[model samples]
Target: MPILRNTKKEAVIKDITVIGGGVVGASTALHLASLGYQITIVDQNNSNIAKNSEHRTGSTASLGVLMGNIFTRHKGRSWELRKRSMEIWPELIKSLSTEELPIIVNTPLVKIASSKEEMIKMENLIKQKKYLGIDFLPDNYQSLPIWIKNKYGGLISYNDGQINSLKLIDSLFLKLKSLNVNIITSKVKYIKRINDNTRIWSVILEDGKAINSHIVIICAAAESERLLQQLNYKLPLTKILGQAIKLKFKNSQVNFSGWPAIVNIKGINLIPEQPDSLLIGATLENELSPDKKYLHQMLETIREKAEWMQNYLIKEKWYGHRAKPINEPAPILKSIEKGLIINTAHYRNGVLLSPACAEWVSLEINKFHQ
Candidate 1:
């Protein structure tokens, strides 16, 4: 009888609250709302859903590089998660068709080996591509761009796609609004469980307002650990700060829109954002925030390493933080207690992994009913 009561509570569960309005949180809200669950999304900044600023969130600052099979080093859980996420991209795009946002860029991905050892590894990965839909570009591959200095070798994966991260988040928000989902702008001060075993949680905001829900999912990225710590659940999540730069070619004749994203083994990448503008990024730093001096040096290093970028003009430079679980390569999805779900720590693959994580978390929550 007691178990039936819990199961009844689960089956009848209606109100769901999602903390953090990032891509993962937004996608979760969209899916849960579509499933007919009442959802309220709480975020510290409501502007994130409307316009992801370069200074605000990492998702917007990203070049939206969907590596797909090109990121062959990931295996086990990480690889599976990415593959599943890729599979859902088309469906997710169809759902956003009415929004008219830039849903996806069907572009290829090219990865260059940084060294001879890296080249060997690439060769092996290509030979062992299995069903990953990748192609090996031998050293003599003539289609290589003149600007690209691939001394080792290159591998191309044709199925990779990209999206404007900011627009994607905004589209999610629009989808949520169309579904009549409630959007609350506030910082969650603390989450209070109704009791040790009840299927309800109360999210207390910084403004002293509280919202009780049948379930609460935390997709707060870098802030997830602190919120979990407040609930006495310790998760080892590190905040890695990254900086990226946007450059436009000084000469109008240069066009990069059709170019596949060029990435090296060391993780330095150049992705085209538009015809004349290319987005080059990203130095992973141990610090939690960006230091002006260090960021300048990091950008300089990126410029020097990619000597071909010398012809481009700097448009803007920005930085954002991604969350990584200590010593863990994959994002985490776990239910600590009844109706409490943690969905965070996506690291560099947030855009690539959000869809699958959202789907996984939704299914995990639904399991309570079953």
Candidate 2:
């Protein structure tokens, strides 16, 4: 193990250095910190880039939809990660709540079926989920909200909920601060293993600063590919552009209380915000720029189903890129080497799966040490 000298010239064992300060990275730091590991987080912390909607990270641009329970896949790594995350979210929210950080929006997720095929799939899932003790409301047109106009009805997953992504990140940083985790605001230039025998790694920052640690976890999303490529590891990651629009209901009398976040079979989400506004997103486009037509079409689809939205005014539209794996499953959660971990490429479900991904990283570290 690599040891460093403190100001008093005493030997101090180095610990973990996590690259990336987004939701996944922040959550991973918190998880590791709670486990008594000395943790350091290196983030670029570009305020101007974060402010620009087009350049915002996936977590910031997301509508914060937690669709774990509603996901049709009942088996595989994806489902397992979603299941684990759903279990952790409540505990995390409660812990954060003690600090008066209201990051979670407690509401069920309602997934509406656009076709008979989707309804059948939901039916089969309801049966399969019942065996696992996952509750799902019976699909009934009358059971849906008054505004939703779907002929095939919808399924409600009470266990699923949403969170404010930005707020969650902020609260996580505060929690990390209370835990005394070191957070560095700089971009990582490259990462290299300092000693093969000792398994110690060095994270080199853009400003020529090197942070030495026993373990390094890469949660830098699209940037992970570049970082790994320098180490002769090809991490194929493609950036998928996603756009969302915020709209406000013109009619103040519109009641959004107790409303569940709605998701269509096409994967577009219509989330109800506080007051009389709704956040509708997002389009997975391959192009560079935000396509206004995609947002328009999505809005029209929602307006067609929910007539009340016809009178709403467009508030704002934003876009962000999500890192997706090439020819591989989402979330690329695994240790690439003895001490280097890759936990990025969550794609669209970064916020939804962050807690589980973080826990997985912690478990990997423990297992390796054992």
Candidate 3:
């Protein structure tokens, strides 16, 4: 473990390297850059993974649903992370919006209850969260959208919303560049301690390049396990496959105005990408490739509720791998060693939890200097 020290006259400025360029990594870089650290982000730039049908990263494949206030869990680590992120999201979005970045769609999230049992659960949740601006609607509610067919009631969380993950990352990078943070397009081969005494890290790239940093935070999702193995440190992480599809409405006059950006039916999410297009998806599987059967089954579930969905044509389909921790709670946000931190393995909640996790990484780095 490296020992970091600061002089009394002035605080030492440290070089920090983040090993992923996804939402989590980009958010971390932006947060650290705000703290006036020398930041460098390295990513392999696998942007074309969708066209190539390769292993897609979680950030790009996500539907970007932010269900913080709507989450069932009200207490525990998960809730804490979600709460913190929710608190930061508004300010973050406002700051970004000041720069004219359209990263988030500020709309409420509607979670429909498909079964009577689910309806009862939602009813109880509505009572419990009455102070949180959550609204419950019965099946006969007058304002329910005509497109959705529901026998059971639903809950609407006004504070929860959806994000445009791709735009969020792009906006963060733009902010990083404005802050003079260095962005590198490369793959890190491994990281090793420069010396036992100084605690500096030598981040070696595949191209025979080595960049030294005072701190290294691994936000590489499932790839973090392989990187840690190089240092003989083990963190059990597995990749969970999630698939989603985009659909375009055939009817040009279809009216979807004033609709919430996200509508979660059962375990599936329906997102509005545009007025005439919808994004539905996300099946969690333990395989490397997408399961067509599962994807269709999810679509079928949605189709059963909304017959109008039959008029929509599939525009695109994509899948990505999310990192899940085996036998551990998700979102391993902590410093394993003095100068080494791991903030990956967020699984499906990467988009929702990245901001809080990034703040965690920055605090850990600050602790070292203290």
lDDT of each: 0.75, 0.79, 0.81
Q: Which ten residues in a row have the lowest lDDT in candidate 2?
A: 1-10
Give stretches of model 2 more than 4 Å off: 1-14, 46-54, 131-146, 263-265
TM-score of decoy 2: 0.90
lDDT of 3 by residue, 1-370 (tens): 0111211223474688999988899888888877778899888884333443434678888888888877777899899888888878887876665346666556788888888999888888888777777888533433645467767778888888988876776677778889898888889999999997888888998898988988898999999999999999898999999998888898866556657778888879888778888888789899988888888888888879886776778788888999999979998887878788999999989999988888878767667643
Report the lDDT tens digits of candidate 2 across residue range 227-333. Answer: 99999999898889999888887886665765665544468887777668888889988877788788778877777777777677878778888999997989999
For each predicted model, how many residue pairs clash, with residues at least 3 apart or on different chains?
A: 0, 0, 0
lDDT of 3 at 2: 10
How big is the RMSD of model 1? 4.8
Steric clash pairs (candidate 3)? none
Model 3 clash tally, residue pairs: 0
Best by lDDT: 3
User: Lowest-lDDT window of 10 residues in candidate 3?
Assistant: 1-10
Off by over 4 Å in 1: 1-10, 48-54, 73-75, 138-145, 261-265, 292-307
